[model samples]
Target: MADYTIRVYKNRDYNAVRMLFAEGMLEHIPATCAHVLKLPRAQFVLFISFITLLLISRSYLLSLVSLAIVFTLGRRLLTSEFHQYVESCQRDDLLDIEESYMASNNSCFWVAESNGRVVGMVGVVPRSSEVMLLRRLSVAKDKRHQGIANALCHKVIDFARQRSFKALTLETSMVQVASHKLYEKLGFQKTDVRVFPSLFGRFANFSVLTYEYKLRH
Candidate 1:
């Protein structure tokens, strides 16, 4: 909260950026679990399964076993989802950030510095000739409630405009409610909500909300 400056990504800030991203993302697990449990399919399956087991055996042990099984399945499903997202991040972006972002003239990464330390970071990767994906935005946990995130976002938006991008967009999980607020405050509008396809996506049952900031003349 004292003072912070936003600057282009430096090689030295890579590790800090990675750590901030991992920590910020991992913080969503609990929220994701709660959201998953509230889904209609989860409630129906858990209730029916438990009730059926109770009526068939009436044994507390069997009922508990059934509960454990169902709960474990849900937990494992979410854990797998978490890992998949993390792996995708590492494989697609974080692993070779320089090669993935720095090497390209259209892609750029930035970090927020305070007290001479990397406290926050954000990046923009060109998704098409006219669009950029605003991604990897995060701030240190202890550094929240400050203006670091806002500054980082402003910097990314300016960068996009200066580079003639037509729009800036991002995807965030439903669990990332706080981020949604930030994006909205920055003039990004929620445009869509979608879940990934395939068995794992069905089992885990999470939705990603997409937001877009259309640049205007």
Candidate 2:
């Protein structure tokens, strides 16, 4: 068990939150790239493309080089998508805490402090009058699985219920199995899943899962 304090997010926590989110999300890229590449469709396409190159070039050396280049380019494209998401988060949310989350009274953000340092974060924003969207649940890499995530989750649940929100909901990627377990433990149900809509998303073919917690019932 880590000794920590959980409290409302402050302007000073911006850099830490951004850093944690980026590092955590980026850590998944290697797994994500391999996941994408291992798909039957992905492997088939790569194989077909390589064979075409071999026939055209008719040089075993050049064909192997071309195949390697394709693998590199494909991985780069998938990795860049993750980078772009982190950049978008920095631009939209981390740029100004007050204006983005704290501006509206219904929306609130919080952080967990361990040894006087920001080590975890979670936030709730209004999706509608009766519902709140729980977003960006992150804990420090070294400090995870020590109940910090559960504590932060309980804090947000209490906050939303106190505000009379009917339900709390969140979106997460399918690869985030750990997060899924945490949300499930907290009584959120898997309500929906959608394919990533971005161009890179189409190629990667991974889907996002949405979870919901009905406060009243």
Candidate 3:
């Protein structure tokens, strides 16, 4: 509903885009923590830790305090992983948007500008000759639900269609339920699900979901 414009990424928008991405990714920490806490393994570990501490100290107060500390540390561990992911992204394709996206004929990145501010962004790269991988779709927290994300997604979809790609594919973490709903609404179908391929993810049973939108030639 808010007024905005979508355009190709430029060098000046680098800092804004990177900051938006880091913030967007970090915002999922609470959801990730909740998902991790629901796992049977996490509960079992917490229970065992509490019991062990209680047996060693023979005091309910001390045991409860220790349990709280363990819970806090667990949350910190997840937070650290999220930070590391953000850093890795900064070092990767995000380090230079122009080279990583606009430099290629089949790959590009776009950002949504509202009142001269970068409010949303999305990118696409060829996965094969026929498939395009949609990546880095993010909208500023305060500017969401204003059709920014929807527009960005459509931009990629339109680009893929124009480029004669067969399908658009993307992967999102399990905790991103809202993102899943958005992708499904835009006609993407769930194709696969897999563990996150990290020690924390394995221990917490964290997973990622892949979705694909096929285009008609």
Candidate 4:
């Protein structure tokens, strides 16, 4: 396996995280669009209109102008109240699995870096005296299947074990089968189903699957 370093995220690493998210968003644009379709009607209309403008503009100057408008509108849409609501839902989901890792407590966050560039990350938050919740596990597309996630996960598991955590829990969506399989391969067992109210309210209905792993000394 290629050597990589795992460390906590730093203030300077914020940009790297943003870039990674942007790249992942672009990679999953089709799925992202499908998710966007679940937005409220008004939001959907605005989003579709922007896409229509991007597709229909012909002349170079007109296209550039339309692109600029689209970008401005896109930024507004991303930062709008509805968007914030959706983002909060996501954050809540993450917290539901693990909240202690968010700049507080004895929780831990690890980022996998190779040649000085971040390639993956995992977040763990203490849930109780003997359990921790793991969330936001991700690996860049180019780094997938290369053990980056495995290494990061192992590091967190080791940290938790050393701290005397007896169990680790996580939640993953059906859309993320690979992640589910990874968790299973890491010795996690299916625990139960989690229902996020915000997700159900937005997507009409969806399921969040939960998993757990018992640590052994």
* C-alpha TM-score for every candidate: 0.88, 0.92, 0.98, 0.65
- lDDT per residue for candidate 4 within 1-217, as digits (tens), equals 6778888876555556655644543443344345544658646666566567657874656666776676566445533533554455446533332333545655877788888988887788788889988867788998888888888888888988988889999886645678888889999999887554563334523456899999998
Q: Compared with the true structure, what per-residue lDDT tens digits does model 1 show for residues 30-112?
A: 88788768778878988898888999999878997989988998788777767777778877789888887789778888888
Query: Each candidate's lDDT (Cα)?
Result: 0.84, 0.88, 0.94, 0.69
| Model 4: pairs clashing at backbone N, Cα or C within 3 Å | none
- The candidate that wins on TM-score is 3
Worst 10 residues of 2 by lDDT: 92-101
* Candidate 2 residue-wise lDDT, 79-122, digit = tens: 88999999998888777777778888788889999887889998
Residue 75 lDDT in candidate 3: 95
Better of 3 and 4 by TM-score: 3
Misplaced by over 4 Å in model 1 are 203-205
Question: Pairs clashing in candidate 1?
Answer: none
Model 3 lDDT tens row, 1-217? 5599999999999999999999999999998898888888889999999999999999999999999999999999999999999999999999988999998899999999999999999999999999999999999999988888999999999999999999999999998888999999999999999998999978877889999999987
Off by over 4 Å in 2: 59-62
